[model samples]
Target: MSLTRKRKKELKRLRSGAEDLWTQQQEVLANANALAAEARKQAAYYTREEIAPRVRGGYDQYVRPAADTAKATAGRYVGQARERVVTDVIPAVGTAVGTALSVVDHARAARSAAFAGEFKKAGKELTKKTKAATQNSGPGAGSVIAIGLGIIAAVGLLYAVWQTFRADDELWVADEEPAAPASGTTQQ
Candidate 1:
C-alpha cells in the first residue's frame, strides 16, 4: 500500500532474477569451455606444415608491406631532418647573430644617450656656478660688505655718544622744584 513497501518488493524480485541469470551464464560458460577443448583436440591432428604456409603467406601479403612502408617513411624523415639541419639551422645561426648585434647596438645607443644627458647636466651646473661666482664676486665680497657696514655703524654710534658727552655741563643738571603735599603717597 506504501511506496517504500512497493520499492522493496521490486528490489527483491530483481535480485532473484539476477541470481537466475547468473546461474544460466555459468552453465553457458561451462558448455563453451567443453566445446573449446573438443575443438583443440581436433586441431591437434593437423601438422605444422599445413598451418605454416598459410601463416607465412598472410605475413607476406599484409605484414611485409606494412614493414616496408614504415621503413620508407623513416628514411624520408631522416632525409628531411638532414636537409632541415643544413638549410634552416645554419641560416638561423646567422640570424641569431644579427639579432644579438642589433641588441648590442641598442645598448650602445642607450649608453650614448645617457652620457649626453649627463654631459648636458654637468654643463648646466657649471654654467650656474660660474654665473653665481661672477655676479657675487665670491664669498670674500660678502664678508667685506658685512664688515664695512659693522664698522660704519660702530663709528656713527661712537660719534653720537661723543657729541652728547661734549655738550655744555648745564644740560646735565636737573632742575629742582618744590614738592607738593601728598595724600599718604610720594612720587614713585
Candidate 2:
C-alpha cells in the first residue's frame, strides 16, 4: 500500500477510538449524577422517618427520664452533702477552732511567762545597780570630803608662807648684834 493511504487509515481508527471513549465518559458522568440524586433523596427520606423518630423518641423516653433522674439524684446528693457538712464538718470546724483557741491560750501564757521573766531580770539588774550605788556612796562622799580638807590645808600653808614673807622681821636676824663686832678683834 502507499504511505498516505496507510496513514489515513490509522488516523481514522484512532479518531473512532477517541469518540467511543468520550461517549463512555459521558455515560459514566450521567450515571454518577443520577446516583448522587437518588442517594440525596433516600437520605432525606431516611432522616425524616427513621432518624427523626428515633431522635425524638430517645429524647422523650430515655433522655428526659435520665435527665430527670440525674437532677433528682443531684438534689438528693446536695441535701445529703449539706447534712453531712452540718453533722461532720461543723463539728470538725468547731474542734479546730477550739484547738486554735487552746494554742492561742498556750501562746499567751508563754508570752506572759516570758514577759514576767524579763521583768524579773530587769528588776534584778535594777537591784544590782542600786546595791552597787549604795555600797560606793559612802566612799565617794568620804573621798570628796578628804579632797576638800587637803585643799583647805594647802591653802592655809600657802597663806602662812605669804604672811611670813610680808612681815617686817629680818629673815636672818642675829640673837645679839654679832657680839659688838668682836670688840675690835684685838682682844684675841
Candidate 3:
C-alpha cells in the first residue's frame, strides 16, 4: 500500500513514542532491580543482627531450661521405675515363686510321710497353718457389696449432675416450632 504524507508523519510520531516508552520501561526495571538488591541486603543485616540474637536468647532463656527440666523429670521417673523393679517387683515375684515351689515340695513330702504313718501329727499342724493363712482380716462380703453400691451411687450422682449442668444444644427442648422455609425453596 502507498502511504499518504499525513499517514507517514503519524507513523514517525508513533515510532518515537514507542521508543520513549521502551526507554522508560528499561529505567523502571533497573530501579526495581536496585531496590530489590538493597532490600535483600537489609534483610540479611536484620536477620544477622536482630533476629538471630533474639532467637538465640529465646532458646537459651526459655527452651533450654524447659528442656532440662523435662529431661530431669523423665530421668527421675525412669530411675524410680528401675528402683521399684529391682527392689519391690523382683523380690515379690521371687518370694511368690519360692513359696509356691516350697508348698509343692512340702505337700509331696507330707504324702510320702503319710505313707509311713507319720502324717497324723503333721496333718493337724498343716490344717492349723492352712486355717490361719486362709482367715484374712480384710473386708467381708457385705462390706464389699456396700462399697460397690456406694461407688455406683456416687457414679450415678455424678452422671445426674453432669446431665443437669452440661451444655448440649441437641438435648435442649425448643419452646417453639421452627420457622418454615421460604416459599421459593423445596425440600428434597
In order, what lDDT does every prediction score? 0.73, 0.75, 0.80
TM-score computed on alpha carbons, candidate 3: 0.48
Tens digits of lDDT, candidate 3, 1-188: 99999999999999999999999999999999999999999999999999999999999999999999999999999999999888876665565555546567666766776778897856864675466446646644444545666799999999999999999999878799889877986779
Query: Residue by residue across 42-132, what tens digits does model 2's lDDT show?
Result: 9999999999999999899989999999999999999999998888766755654554465565556555655778666555555554564
Query: TM-score, each model?
Result: 0.33, 0.51, 0.48
Best by lDDT: 3
Candidate 2: lDDT over CA atoms? 0.75
RMSD per prediction, one decimal?
Answer: 40.4, 46.9, 11.1
Error of 2 at 150 (Å): 81
Which candidate number would show the highest TM-score if scored against the true structure?
2
Residue 125 shift from truth in candidate 3, angstroms: 21
Ordered by TM-score, highest first, the candidates read 2, 3, 1
Can you rank all candidates by lDDT, best first? 3, 2, 1
For candidate 3, give the lDDT of residue 37: 100
**Which regions of candidate 1 fall more than 4 Å away from where they truly are?**
1-38, 44-49, 112-188
Q: In model 3, which regions exceed 4 Å deviation?
A: 90-188
